[model samples]
Target: MDNIISKLRNLDAYPKINEDFYSRTLSGGVITLSSSILMLLLFISELRLYLHAVTETKLVVDTSRGETLRINFDVTFPALPCSLLSLDAMDISGEQHLDVKHDIIKKRLDSHGNAIEARPDGIGAPKIEKPLQRHGGRLEHNETYCGSCFGAESADDDCCNSCEEVREAYRKKGWALSNPDLIDQCKREGFLQRIKDEDGEGCNIYGFLEVNKVAGNFHFAPGKSFQQSNVHVHDLLAFQKDSFNISHKINRLAFGEYFPGVVNPLDSVQWKQETPSATYQYFIKVVPTVYNSVSGYTIQSNQFSVTEHVRTAEVGRLQSLPAVFFFYDLSPIKVTFTEEHVSFLHFLTNVCAIVGGVFTVSGILDSFIYHGQKVIKKKMEIGKFS
Candidate 1:
């Protein structure tokens, strides 16, 4: 046992020296103190990096299928009245929503841009109490009131009970209601009078659009939309004007739920139509994104970049109506972000390296300085120093 103990002592790498024979100098003490502070600082820096999570980013081809995208928008048409403004959406899948009023709110604004009143958009006025039984017929008091759709009816027995139904019939027949006053339902419901009442007022329309996850377009235009001679036109409500001002501002527009570090470029965007009337278009490219947090939570969202264009109208030769159109397309690639901390073993290894490296360098520097000073002093004592 004694021999084994002696062998272990001989094998010890760190041999100790007696205090009486040890030499301590000011230079050595200074180097020791400096190196210790450096080691402490390096250790603190490494610890901080290990504790805080770092995010890793990667790009991959998006393979998602059969999903729907939700679009939230808040737009203000400062010169277009709510009575003349209409919303429409269409996609590549042959799906269309005309005169969208569901989940929508319209705020009437005055000239100074202050809201005068807010209300939900409706399908026009209430049903007329006394409707015409047929075109050029007498006002008869009957139990079942089958109003006339005029010549726009698809079937002879078809009936239009309200002004809205007549307009719908006209629309289906690819015709425009040039004069609503001639129709009794429209005359009694005051369609043109309603337009005249909301004249010169602005509208702030806020709504969300649910569309297919495909390339599509949604627009805000004046008057009810319909196709005539393969061209899109508005009924205009007989409120004809020399020009229309489609100047507008977008308060906020988001494609999906918000996530950390996501940016919406169209928020607070504004445009003014310098011409008599114009069409403002925005072409947006949306990229899908997935974020995985350190807490094991995941977020699916979208980010987009946009390009804008404006098509002005010629005074009397205008083809397109004054509108604001948003055309969006999806990207094939997707981005992913993951947050994680450094491993414990990696942190420990870095800490040990910093301490060992600083200590060794400081000891070598201290020994060289001490020996050089001693040699210079000895030479001076022997009168060999110059």
Candidate 2:
């Protein structure tokens, strides 16, 4: 056992010091204390960082197919009423959704910006049970009634019972309801009166649009939209006005699910119309993102950059209509975010380096001080240095 102990002691990196050569100074003690404190502080900082999760980002080419993009939006039009405002979405592939209602909610706001009512889209009108007129007159008992489409009907049996139906029929015929006052359905349904009543009220539209992953545009226009001459046009006559206010405030506009540290550039964005008849356009480039949290939760979203432009309406020329248009194109590259924490082994290694490095530096400083003091003492005793 004694032979083994001798061998172990010889192998020790730090040998025991003899008491006769031992010396301690105030400066050395102070430095030792300071280095120890510094090492502890550094170790604590590193440990904290090691314990917390960090997000690492990587970019790759997106090769997804048949994936749909979700657009979540909340927009407020201070001058346009919910009845007059319409939502339309169309893609480069020729798919179109007019007066989009599903998954959409509309809030009626007073001039003060307070919400008065919250309801789904297309909730204003009550459903009619039967057609009111037969051959342009009231139906008699046991008489079959067929509403007229005012020359827009595809067949003689086609019926346009409501003002909206008549308008839709006209849209299909590539014709506008030039004079709603002359239409019996519009007069009875008080469509013109409804527009007048909603004047000065504001609308807050919050909805989600699910669209193809390809490039396309979605717009917020004053009236229902239709295709005429291969061009998208809104029924301006429905509002009983030639111009509209395209001013809007975007409360929230997110491309997909929210993730940690994700910032949507268009949130809380506002624009005031200088002219009543103007077009507000946003050109957007979308980058897909996927986030995987340390807890194994995943979120798929998109980040975007946008450029805005506005064009005033002109009478003679083919002026851009008053609307808020969002044209978005997808990026081929996709970003991935992963949350990770430092391993226990790595944390321990860093701690050891900090402790060993600081101790070695402090010991070297103490050793130099002690040796300089010994040399000076010998010089003074020999009377060779004063």
Residue 98 accuracy (lDDT) in model 1: 81
Query: Which pairs clash in model 2?
Result: none
CA lDDT for candidate 2: 0.87
TM per candidate: 0.81, 0.89
**Residues 1-386, model 1: lDDT tens digits:** 99999999999999998999879999999999999999999999999999999899999999999998889999998899887888999888988888888989999998889999999887765455656677555456655677888798899889887788888888778787888889888888887897778778899999788899999999998877777886667776455665778999999999888877888999999998898778899999999889999999998888899999998866687456789999999999999989999999999999999999999999899999999999988989889645
Model 2: ten consecutive residues of lowest lDDT: 123-132
Clashes of each: 0, 0
Go through the candidates in order and give each one's C-alpha lDDT.
0.87, 0.87
**Model 2, runs deviating above 4 Å:** 1-5, 123-132, 141-145, 314-316, 361-386
State the lDDT of candidate 2 residue by residue for 72-118, as single tens digits. Answer: 99999998888888999999999999889999999998888899888
Q: Distance (Å) between predicted and true CA of 3, model 1?
A: 4.2
Candidate 1 weakest ten by summed lDDT:
135-144
